[model samples]
Target: MSYFLSKLVRFNRSSVVGAVGIVSVGSTLLFSDDDTRFRTFVTARLPLPSQDASLLTLAVPNDLFPPHLPSFGQHGILSLSSYRVGPGSSSDISKEASGAVHDGSKPCGCFGRDTIANAAAKVGPAVVNISIPQDFYGVTTGRSIGSGTIIDKDGTILTCAHVVVDFHGSRSSSKGKIEVTLQDGRTFEGKVVNADMHSDIAVVKINSETPLPDAKLGNSSRLRPGDWVIAMGCPLSLQNTVTAGIVSCVDRKSSDLGFSGLPREYLQTDCAINVGNSGGPLVNMDGEIVGVNIMKVLSADGLGFSVPINSVCKIIEHFKKSGRVIRPWLGLRMLDLNEMIIAQLKKKDASFPNVSKGILVPMVTPGSPGDRAGFCPGDVVIQFDGKPVESMKEI
Candidate 1:
């Protein structure tokens, strides 16, 4: 009787373990559903009515990977490989703050809706990715990235002058060859028809069968602080990437490219401007381009600037006419008039004022306007053409 009782206890333990395994398996199957069934359930329960269901469905791609599908954490599953599409697989789809589709067909009737999507969709086709053939340490290779539009059709492309011009090589000659890649992935050899390093603007031409979508030029001179602005470019080679920020300030003068001498008018925006985004368009509402993204302050956050398009137009005109640009020169050597310099100048000339003000002329061009205007080595220029000459920058 004791042997029989011990055997019965062991049999009961085995049965309990087998029952637990079956129950766990059943629970998993019941909770998880396949792509098709899940979609049906979601569609049925979706907050939208049957009539508006089409719009919600349109937001989702037809092919989306089902939930619970295993994904490796590193190096995302590449696009075409086992990237099963059934429920959520639209690479182009992203959320807009106002829930408005960037479709022109839809009425963006409300004012508060984020117009970024609409703006991006409007200008995206015009922005082209630029690639240049580079020879790094004697190895010929190709480097590709982003730049964008001022003109839509007739193959006229606007980008940062530095993008096409190779500054490393002979500064007198064309820097590097440029290739413009459109949104459709077609590439063409782009020639630097015009460029101005001073203003940092360049125009390239391509022959396309279809009429290109040209960007509508807006008046950057009219741009004010707190105005709505958008920057669209390939940040890190990611094409048609749209970032939204306001015009942090306009007409910000910083000696970013001091080598170019003096500063030009700049539109300061908080938009994330990356290296590849150079030569891309900074647009405003109504889909008009106000500025061209140029450089960003490295040490500070949210500090990015663009060359005003108005300043670029004259340069572009010069490129169209001359095939090169001739930058205007004031032709004078200037130094900041500070206290140390003021004391030294006062010691030399007792007639000079004690207050540190105005730009001190160290040397003036003999044949240039400065010399003609009686400006000498010791002369303190309080004003230049009626503009206050404060520092070397102002001078």
Candidate 2:
């Protein structure tokens, strides 16, 4: 609920700069001085607060030059100091008395504390914890915990495809049993209706005796970077956990990140999400579902990914009608041009041209549309439908 600014220091050698100020977010620092031969030294340590009050004081050395050299400027040495006075301190009390503090706890006529609390109260009931039982050879192997959002009054739940899929990377059939737990401690048997691996989305249905609470779907296209978002899920088997963060990016390509089995674009956020958080809902400030938590980068922190609600809506409609996604197939086997492939190509034939980027077609199906369109083996597909194609996945 409380946010604090973290300081970061960067060093540059190309320019001679002497100043002290708060660095802006994502700002670049450059130094350039052609006349002076300067050797800069930088040392940084974590700030320590005072015991009585959270007051951070940083002292920088004034004498930066060696004893052999004379002072260059009006001051022989420069000393820079900074202080960070914490909340509730004397400085903050003065600001509060002056009405400079913005009270986030009060309603600001918009998405304030009251609105966020009301949104959570309205949507929390619809977020359910999903437990999937993996059965192999008639015996129970193991189980996986995830999260889902009820999308229909009749108990239709929407979750990630990976949640319903078995450990062996196979979709769960109707016979497979899944347990859905509501916030009220009620449990129901769920059946997988349809799942799409490419889009990483699945729909489950549970025949509830009474009507269930459903979440309102929102437009993901309206989401911009820095927009506030709340993620609700059962992370690490903790039920009904909620975390808040900002939208990190709107359109992150899965292929660009070396991630397969994902749609072309995905939503990225900094929300604290964990393993069991998959298939949960990423709600906007208005309490509308904007995305579905899918995956997080294991090697990085706070790099959570989600499937946009708009894309999921399209997939849900398609699955509802056809029970499966029908994808257009291009009968062509191609490889992305890279350094290794270029090296191999040059070794195979000295006449091979040095191409930086393109999809190299190793073979084209004989009777397919590609062959009919005069495509042949060893042909490079630089573009598709007028868009540049760098990878076969893009095509």
Candidate 3:
């Protein structure tokens, strides 16, 4: 008979139901005679709750082995014991709070319901509902609803560029009018000071008779995955809706997600962001804005994405100086090549090189710099100015 120890114990007990019994010396224990194995797994190591900790023992029948493991007719019991060390310092607590030890459950204390409620109460007043009226041939057609965050006491709002721009990707002038509704039920006309399509950010200003509540901006560079966060927005035309979630990832570049034109990193979250949530503020646990909710994957759940607040700040500063964003123009249409693209190209043309990555030029303007430099369709750009171009955004 052979004994096998596993930290994650899973088994198919269809052959033996009444022959097995699981006993726990301490901690919560659950038993089942069904064919399905336990859904949750126990970790090998657990931290000490205090200076003095006791031992915990768990026993399981040897017959409850998974199908992949070797089947041995063992009559002995499998005992698992866990011992806790001394008390951890404050730094260890901080690490745990930052989700260093993710146990698929929310940590206690700092992430309690009261903490989230307080954060929402503190930042709720600064969130505003934005409505843009769409018109065609001097007649009102429809309205676009979104959310915004007040960034200044004088009612300067920050939101997504698409909220203020029309369907044609241009700033809506005669066809639309910007309106901002505050949390206190006050509505005011807002004017688009500037909008940048590259970053999908826009700045709108409302000349309010009284000072408005401005939300505090936090440093997004300090954000980490699993950090507690709240998303405040008007989703599905609901006003002042707040949803809670954790930071799923940081430093996600646009090129990594098949969006090369953005040319910047994004903050990925699992917050319940839906339609009309765009341009809303993604606040941290401290009630400070860390990101702006942009869009989410339509086909997947819990795959929401946000624009980093730091990048939005830079664009806001640039808009303040110049009326519009100034981007270096290289008149060329290109596509970044990946493994799948290279495989498809090789199938069509056998002479195509088995390259790993490159930027494939699809078109070049007639009188553009690319045309002047003798660039043409089907040209693969592998390098630019002595540097390797792995993606179109890099070029």
- CA lDDT of every candidate: 0.55, 0.60, 0.62
Which sequence of candidate numbers ranks them by TM-score, best first?
2, 3, 1
**Which is better, 1 or 2, measured by lDDT?**
2
Q: Evaluated with TM-score, which candidate comes out highest? A: 2
Tens digits of per-residue lDDT for model 3 on 241-271? 7888889998877545543232568898988
Give each prediction's root-mean-square deviation over alpha carbons.
29.8, 21.9, 23.3
Model 2 lDDT, residue 347, Cα = 63
Question: Which parts of model 2 have CA positions greater than 4 angstroms off?
Answer: 1-109, 135-141, 167-175, 260-263, 350-357, 365-367, 382-395
Tens-digit lDDT track of model 1 for 227-298? 677787765555666677888888775443222134456888988665467778998765678888876644
The predicted structure with the larger TM-score, 1 or 2, is 2
Model 2's C-alpha root-mean-square deviation from the true structure amounts to 21.9
TM-score of 2: 0.66
The candidate that wins on lDDT is 3
